[model samples]
Target: MAGAQRLAQTLAGRLDTTFTKVGTPRTPLDADWQAQLASALPELRQLAETLTLRLVEGHKPLAVLPRCAAALATLPVIARHHPDACLIWLDAHGDLNTPASSVSGYLGGMVLTAAAELWDSGLGSGWRLDQVVLADGRELDQAELALITQYDIRHLTSESLTPEALSQAIGNRPVYLHLDCDLLAPGLMPTEYSVAGGPDLAQLYALCSAIGHHELIGLEVAEFEEQPDFAMAEAAEALCDALAPVYERLYR
Candidate 1:
């Protein structure tokens, strides 16, 4: 059981979502994000299609994904209908690394950069840099930092993640939210990447509540690892307990 599935299923029990397993792509693992995308794009394309169908049919998606690269599907699909919608990316890292800049070459790190046409991901770049808001991004790579300065993308630090502040930043524009659970404090939950100095659960709840007002287009969560101590469902419940208000607002 992967962490994503466990977290998603647990979240489903609490939120207004139906749990469906979107299976993984089976291909020889490539060295970096770009090579991986190139190798498994065919299967990933099918995965995107499924998400697209559900979205067009009026489903508010709660996409639980292992890698942020899965946002390759979510971002483009949501942008198709709501081009003007602001994508509020809630994560610890910038995830803005381009192929030329990424030192680690992690696929998740390059997802949004690809969506912004910084690189091609075969799914088409439907999102623009200006239409994105990066919140709670504290642990940024030097390459990501340069890109931010170069593009002047909107980013909010942890202190500025208040609902009032977000509402002011995103007035009258509907929003698509992506959560990488590592945005929470390292000891708070299990995630692939654990950077120090993340927000606590209370702050996460407040951020979600604030975004609820922006008319959530859809939401996707990544980076949540399966916990060994608590049951997966229990961990999900504890971690997402604060986000209930956001779910109620969106699902209601």
Candidate 2:
């Protein structure tokens, strides 16, 4: 929660935008796989509120989809509220796991599929798959690869996305960017769950700047563990600074 608050503060300070901090409840359901999710319901819903507060009011006390689903739910409101918005999903894994298929037992890994509705869930029923663009994704399982191929979702693999390629792919869509810090190479950003070998800092900044040239609704940086590392925080602050101007152009 402190991490999220810090991120919000960083964005508000860098972009000169309004930031609202909401509190979430702690659920004590269980430590096992599915039940652990229920425990996070209150906090997740609070996050959902934070994501969508610009568009609507009222707290819906439900277990929202972990990360991807949360993003999916927020997108429609962003699109409706700011119709020109597009989505850039930056992660190491495709995050397209269903309950039956997921071997890791991690709910965060399943977020993308839930948002895509490739997985069965009542929580993320609101997102349309067409609005999303996958960028810098790697380490996809076979089934997840098939799903991405089946959907024909536009994705640029970490190896393939030169700065030029990334800029062209974004192609002037008003973007809502979701950055899971794991997309960076492991040593550079050790706080994330992504595999080794990804774009370097230069490429990342270029991509963010390119996408920022378009209208940007909101941005979310997820999957940072609470351990404080000056290097990690500095990287995050730089990324936010690069993205701030684009955010300013859109919201301010």
What are the lDDT figures for the candidates, one per model? 0.80, 0.61
TM-score per prediction, in order, is: 0.92, 0.79
Q: Candidate 2 has which clashing residue pairs, if any? A: 86-174
Best by TM-score: 1
lDDT (Cα, tens digit) per residue for candidate 2, span 1-252? 455555566666764655665555244344654675665556555655565664465321111122443453454445556555466788887777778788876677776666656665444443455556778778888877777777777778876776577667767776667777678777655354758787766667777767757655556666554456546566557656655545555555
In model 1, which runs have C-alpha deviations exceeding 4 angstroms?
25-30, 227-231
lDDT of model 1, residue 101: 84
Q: Once superposed on the true structure, which residue ranges of model 2 sit more than 4 Å away at CA?
A: 16-18, 24-30, 56-85, 228-233
**lDDT (10s digit) by residue, model 1, range 1-252:** 288877777777776557877766354485766577777677668768888888888887777887777788678888888889988888999999887888887888888888988888888778889888888799998888888888888888887777788778788898888888888888777776888888888888887877887777777888776667736666688777877766667678
**Per model, how many backbone clashes are there?**
0, 1
